[model samples]
Target: MNQNVATSAPFLVFTDLDGSLMEHDSYSMEAAKPALAELARRGVTPIFASSKTAVEIIAVQRASAITAPFICENGAAVYDSSGKILTAFGLPRASWLDAVHQLRERLSLRFTGFSDWPAERIAELTGLSEGDAGRARSREFTEPMIWQDTQANFQLFQSEIQKLSLTTLEGGRFISIQSQFDKGYAMKWWQARHNQPRPFLVALGDGPNDVSLLAAADAAVVIKSGKSDQLDPQGPATVIRTSIPGPAGWNDGIRQILNLLDSQQLLIY
Candidate 1:
């Protein structure tokens, strides 16, 4: 792959991390190196939009050699390439926890979330190294929780959370408690913030939490996930799925999307 393949216009990529670019268990993005290299060469901006914390996203950014902006904590915050936060959507973690405390006592919604777990516990649960788990534990605007109640109770909890104006998302693993904005809102806000004309948006994700993002893109690719079953994004946006899993699937999806974009003269390399 040429490192000098420059694109005529910016190709905006808003991607998920865990099961899309990074391997589920190994947590490595080695297989996506080809596509990463190509995107870097073409100067196509790849921005991570995940449920990961800033430090976790930083680690991935370092490994992937990406210097563009990133959306963190399930779109609760957006940060620029220079590591500066561009925008924030929700209240701080402490405030949310305060609300959770109230809800827990009042409604008896049984749950265990990232905020309730220490770094060591989180490490054991997610198979991340201690340091990475520590970073993951350092959430800002959201809490990813596991419901420990019956179906009726869970539905009740979801309804009450909604009434509080908070959003509950069912991801591949945890049930995420987030701000009103999802990844799709973050993607759109990032695009709108760009001074350049609207770029062709391409998003790739593999989990159920990624549905909104896939739905928002001009071209969305759903990678095969090892941690979860395939998702059906019920949206009008052009969509595709890779047969392979993990970063191999990611590589295929990005390359294929680039070719399709090139054909439409929407991209150059």
Candidate 2:
């Protein structure tokens, strides 16, 4: 909670948005902006790794004033500081479509493809709320399709590679499949390329989509409120499991990590 310690710790902070940074339904990042910006001013780079599309992530980045590389669509792609595509991991488009079609044919569920369709068409077919659909279209970059509830919707979306996909059902909140992309793979890719002397990698997330990145990090913080724990079988790192929830919990979690770094003399706060 003390602002002094945060500015002294130099570390690569990768965070997930939906439940980690923003509230689940309200989607507010206002509370943490100052701390995040202060961290950046002090030589810490806050990298955003999330299931959101590149466009959506970029908007969040701009809002947060973060110019760091971003992992989008669950690590399907890692965009560099220049915003150029550095590395992309996913199946080919044709193969991805084939898999979707085949899965759609075999199962009993609704289907939608991220194909280059007009936003109107996407909304008509996938039945995404007009507001959410509009946001997807307004973005310069975004995941292609929006599918509804059902195993068919889940499988059809996950059957492909290359681009990341998000599946939202009627009674359920959205769930992002690792498939050909995600946070874990993105963070690992970044670590390999930069090869910086990492003080101690830490990842904080709130959902199954964050599991991969959490597993990859030296330390992980899982926000407990939603179904994230049920979605994650492995759970968070044993080192610091603060009982605080939401943004308060996240801030506390980071403080805990900084405490460890300070004790080790790796940081000064």
Candidate 3:
């Protein structure tokens, strides 16, 4: 956590990375600078909750010149501003990979995950540079894959993995298999650690994987991503749907929330 921001700050923001804060195809966050700067100015902490790896999140933090805690691997782990693992909700990556291997052999599943491809291949698939792809491949908790099998086979695969105490998250671009946990679980853990009087929780995301996080927040921002499976959080949070997509939507959503908070005089500063 950044020491400049008080632990009892009035607001805490949780945001997903790809397709929410970053562009869906280009992975750029240029349009969100205004909102990000406003949060910084207001001493509000933004916690990144995403399916990205710790190193990938760290790289984003460094580039953005912000230091805050992050939830990675679809809520498998939480890391501090210094990229230190504060807590983990899942088992080791090797264990999940081994289970996947066994399931594939037994069920003849068809999928190519990060472990099955070289950094170059991953770069080709995700449009990431080779260096970024390598960072992404350094997984500690989950296996993100491109599911190439039939729908029936995929259903069977999910059933088989569930038997092993693992589950899948359908991210914007891949299906991630990991230990049974969601972003909401990790967010609650982070909040418990930081609570003084309990900050106003805000969350933003654009995929099914983000549903849990959105539901857990006091305010939910659903960014438009052109996907048919639009997220509809079933929680009691005040929901804000963005008309635009990506960081532009993210920017609008955050500003709108801040405006609401200001009007209510809920903001401390």
Candidate 4:
């Protein structure tokens, strides 16, 4: 968290899951709860923007006791506070499997397509380790696509999917294949549809997957992880870097934002 940010009611806070909010191993939220509640008390809302499925995002929202807006599937769907389906925008409905089948036939490449499949089925397709496959399938928190040797396949998939008017986002493990999607598009849609206040917006994320929404915010914070380099390669003013890692980084980071609020006499208790 950076001390230079502004904090005011009606502020919008967007955060990424996994490495940004929860520890890689423990998935803890002990420190985050109070900060969230405080934001709610101050009329600030927390929006979850992550490369997770709708089902996974719903469960996390419930677990965190947050009812704010959520961006799922790396900004494919946005859910409002009441849990109503605010909007769905992303990849065209053409069959991805059919596209892959066609591309592989024409370009001579290997590829696979997955929907909301069971853990075992996903593991079988991607040949992921048992533990990794189990986590992906369990859906206790996140639902991510599994890709088998993604790099080579993704390039081909991108060109092919584009033919069908769709795009793919690179998940750390699995590649999220969908119609052209970007977190910024989803965020802008939310802002436009809701006509929400233009309060100081803050976003925090880790991973190359989060680059777009990180750039969309009034102020952005990057968790000191491998993906930090992906943000503002050319440099940006509103971007801030965190020193801590994972959930600890979130705690320290948000605290820094809140402290800035305190300094400005904006936050109460």
In terms of lDDT, the best-performing candidate is 3
lDDT of 4: 0.64
Tens-place lDDT digits, model 1, residues 123-144:
8888999999999988888888
Per lDDT, what order, best first? 3, 1, 4, 2
- The C-alpha stretches of model 4 lying farther than 4 A from their native spots are 1-8, 92-94, 121-154, 194-197, 233-236, 264-269
Residue pairs clashing in model 1 are none
The most accurate candidate by TM-score is 3
Candidate 2 lDDT score relative to the true structure: 0.59
Clashing pairs in 4: 1-253, 91-179, 166-179, 167-179, 167-180
Residues 1-269 of candidate 2: C-alpha lDDT, one tens digit per residue: 11222323455678887666776555677656555655655677767887666776766666655677888766778887656878777543443455545555676446454454666764564354455455555422223444555765565445442243523212114332224455687787777664345445678877666777787877777766555544442533333554655566677777667666658833421
Residue-pair clashes per prediction, in order, are: 0, 6, 0, 5
Local lDDT at 236 for model 1: 28
Off by over 4 Å in 3: 1-5, 265-269
Candidate 2's TM-score reads: 0.71
All candidates: TM-score: 0.90, 0.71, 0.94, 0.77
Q: lDDT per residue, candidate 3, 166-259, as tens digits?
A: 8888888898988888898899888887646776788999998999999998788999886614788887348899999999999999999989
